[model samples]
Target: MKDMTAFLPYASTANRPPLRPKLAPSGAGASAYATGPKAAKQTQTLRDNDDTELLTLFRNASFEQHFQPGSTVLLHGDPADAIYLVVSGTIRCCTVDSEGRRQIFAFPKKGDFVGVSDIDRWHFTAEAVDHVIVKSIPRLTLEQELAVNISLRLEMRTLMGGLLARRERQMLTLVSTKGPERLYRFLEEFAATRSGGGHIVLPMCRRDIGDHIGLSMESVCRAFSDLKRRGLIDLKSHEKYKLIGNAGRDATPLPLHADL
Candidate 1:
């Protein structure tokens, strides 16, 4: 097995931006987003002057390009020549056991950074959960930028710290809770962090949420039912939710136990 302990310190230094406060539709505002395959194809031609400048400076640095869903972006032992950024779609970071059971580490949304392991190679594999577009930047170049740009370096350090903290909390929840509580906590957290108001636009499916939260798909569905019955949330649609009260207030009173 890969020695993840040694890399914990580095992982602790990433993902610190304030959560984007507004809940705008994907591709509805000034924020740049790469969606499906068609949008990814159009990104190259649609760039304005600023976009072109950034893209050109990093263009010579090439990484692997693939357009397939369920494809492995990086295997457990593959060299981390570069950090992979999701240009479009979702990428699931996960670890698999010798028995081939998989536990998802995180679901990196658009604009999230992946492959932050300090070592030369990744300790986990990143798989495309949908059709994806990824951009890879050389480690050397990243280091160079960090060395020269103090602000950028600090930003990266903060981002890494936040990401590590979030993952650590998720791991703790996975080991200590039942599927229902885990699913509830996951939705509560997602709603609070990403959704601006009562409306929540879910980026991933029930199966994806189940994998990440250490729950079966059926359990996740049942938790949603419980939440709705309690009048805590409403199912706006399959991929959307509307919070009735504060999203996570119900969870606040519960004590942490081995099985929640």
Candidate 2:
């Protein structure tokens, strides 16, 4: 009805190489990219063509669907009849506690798949973060395709492994890091993979960001201020920002570029 992380598989960064700063090798931080370029390269290799092949199969069986901002894509505990392929816009996966506090787990963007983890019922609620389009492929169809196709099955396994790795990295970030560091790391990953030309357009609002990063909205604001103060980011507006340099605590010049 209202609120979800189902460990949704993200789009591969194979086409767009990571824009990492040449920071000296330090202890592994909680940031997802803290594994650095080598780890990212390994991940990219694992994900190669998985999205393309998965989409091709799912598209053959899926029907097109659309939603506006704040619309519920799927409810928690509903039968996991189908998984969704994001064609456009973003899906906010999160849950609400008894106190009505929300916690965001992931934002499933274009080329990402949602509801892949569940076999019978959905674990979290999926909400449209903005105007969205998705391809809804029935669970049975997906299972059948996976069963008959060895190559597809192996690819899906690799894809799921990558998703779990990222989920683990993010969990570590949430548990070990404070608000400002968590927010900065989130921005770094998004800028490296999703944004281009040092420009970032936040699809979700501050509240959503706080929910995702385990901070209050006020804290999220403070974190943004902190980034600005540290010269890590130039906030053109609340929803938009320009990346100035390295977001690391060392505060060196780091430029970000997105091939996509």
List lDDT for all candidates, in order. Answer: 0.60, 0.68
lDDT of 1 by residue, 1-260 (tens): 37533333212111113212132233121112323223122234333464332243234443434434554566565667677666667777876555334567777755567765554877776666666677766688777766776766666677779988987887787898776667667777666656476578776667667768877777788878777766666888878887666546475653333232
Displacement of the residue 222 alpha carbon in candidate 2, Å? 0.5
Error of 1 at 41 (Å): 15
* lDDT for each residue of candidate 2 in 1-260, tens digit (9 for 90 to 100): 33233333211111112212133132112112112221111112223354466766754566677765655677666678887888889888876654356667889988789987788977677776777788777788889888888877887787779878988988898998878778887887777767568568998888789989999889999989988877778999998887676546364323222211
What's the number of clashes in each of the models?
9, 4
Off by over 4 Å in 1: 1-66, 196-203, 246-260
Which regions in candidate 2 have their CA more than 4 angstroms from the true location? 1-52, 246-260
Best-matching candidate per lDDT: 2
Residue 255 lDDT in model 1?
33
